[model samples]
Target: MLEVAVIVLAVFSVLLAAACGWLILSQRHLAALQAERDAVRDQRLKELSKRLDTYLTGSVRMGEELYELRRVVAPLPDKLTQIEQRDPSSLSFTQAARLAGMGASVDDLTQSCGLSKAEAELVSKLHHAQHPTS
Candidate 1:
């Protein structure tokens, strides 16, 4: 009876040792997977930072170009108004498109002209006064 009890104790010890070994291996595998995930996350963040830097630089360059264009066309408004007043009704399509960018409405004066939001409102009022739909 004593020998049988000793054999049972020895079997329990062997199972406990195997369980501990499996737990250690599982812990190592989990740590390795976590390390790989962290590396990928770091790489993605670096790529996003590089892309943002590139976009910001391009936007600044575009803004400078627009500023230069505005400076070059600074006198266009005064010249356009002078020509518009001379022959408002007979202005060409290109002239009206340009004037629309300014604060003028040549739509009522010339049917072929396009008007912006503000200019279109003024054109509506002038059209109503000139040719009222009574």
Candidate 2:
């Protein structure tokens, strides 16, 4: 009876040891899985950071280009005003051309727009050439 009791005790000890071993193996596997997950997360973070940097760089470049374009275009209105002031007679010519476009006769262009008869004739001829009878 004592020997049977000893054998049963030994069997329980063996079972306990096996349970501990299995627990240890499970813990190791869990740790390895956690490490793999961390590695993947870190890789994804690095890729996202790189993409963000590229996007920010492109945005900055575009901003700079816009600033340069604005600077280049800023003087255009002033230059156009100066040109108009320099050649006031050009305004009369423009009026004469518009009168010619509206089917006004040469006499009307000369009288209304203050153009010479020769200038009125030239504006009428140019307008007819550009807009022929269809």
Candidate 3:
């Protein structure tokens, strides 16, 4: 009986040691996998930062071009007014309306074309008074 008890105790000790060794190996593998994942994440973040910098540089260049165009065309409105003053009779009704600042004018012949209903009514009244149907 004593010999049987000693053999059983030895078998239990061997199983406990094997279980501890397997647990330690599994923990080491898990740590290695986590380290590799962190490295990949850092590399992706650097690439995204570079791409954003490029887009911001392009946006600034486009804004400068737009400002330059606006400066170039700054004198156009005055030049157009001078030409109209020199030859007012040759200007169309819509052009006259815009110059007079009256929302409705005689030259707007097309119905519902750009002008609102009130504008059209004003234009109709002016047309009738200038050339009565009777």
Candidate 4:
């Protein structure tokens, strides 16, 4: 009976040792898997951070460009108003010149734009000189 009991005890010891070794191996594998997962997570975070930084930089640059454009364009309305308020005689001359360019006769320029005959003739000559017969 004692011999049978000793054999049973030896079998149990061997089984326990095998179970302990398996547990140790499983623990090492789990640790390696966890390390790999952590590395992948860190890499993803770095990529996301870079993309966010790039987006922010571009947004800031666009904002600056818009501000500059607004500053440059702010006085355009006043300048246009000044141009619109210039001398009425100058406007008439400009009309005469445009009419002459469009192939209107000197008499037409004098009648339509209220220019003198000499001014209409000069404008017609200037237009003809600048744009000769094609």
Name the top lDDT candidate. 2
Clashes of each: 0, 0, 1, 0
lDDT of 3 by residue, 22-58 (tens): 9999999999999999999999999999999999999
Off by over 4 Å in 3: 1-7, 86-134
TM-score of 2: 0.61
Checking candidate 4 for backbone clashes, the offending pairs are: none
- Lowest-lDDT window of 10 residues in candidate 3? 103-112
Q: Candidate 2, 2: how far from true, in Å? A: 4.7
Task: Please state the error at residue 31 of candidate 2 in Å.
Answer: 1.1
Per-residue C-alpha lDDT of model 4 across residues 1-134, encoded as one tens digit per residue = 99999999999999999999999999999999999999999999999999999999999999999898667656644543353356643687678767877889999988997867876776676666556691
TM-score of each: 0.54, 0.61, 0.53, 0.61
Tens digits of per-residue lDDT, candidate 2, 20-117, equal 99999999999999999999999999999999999999999999998986676566445435644667767976787678778999999889977678
User: Highest TM-score among the candidates is held by which one?
Assistant: 2
Candidate rank order under TM-score: 2, 4, 1, 3
Ranked candidates, highest lDDT first: 2, 4, 1, 3
Off by over 4 Å in 2: 1-5, 92-134
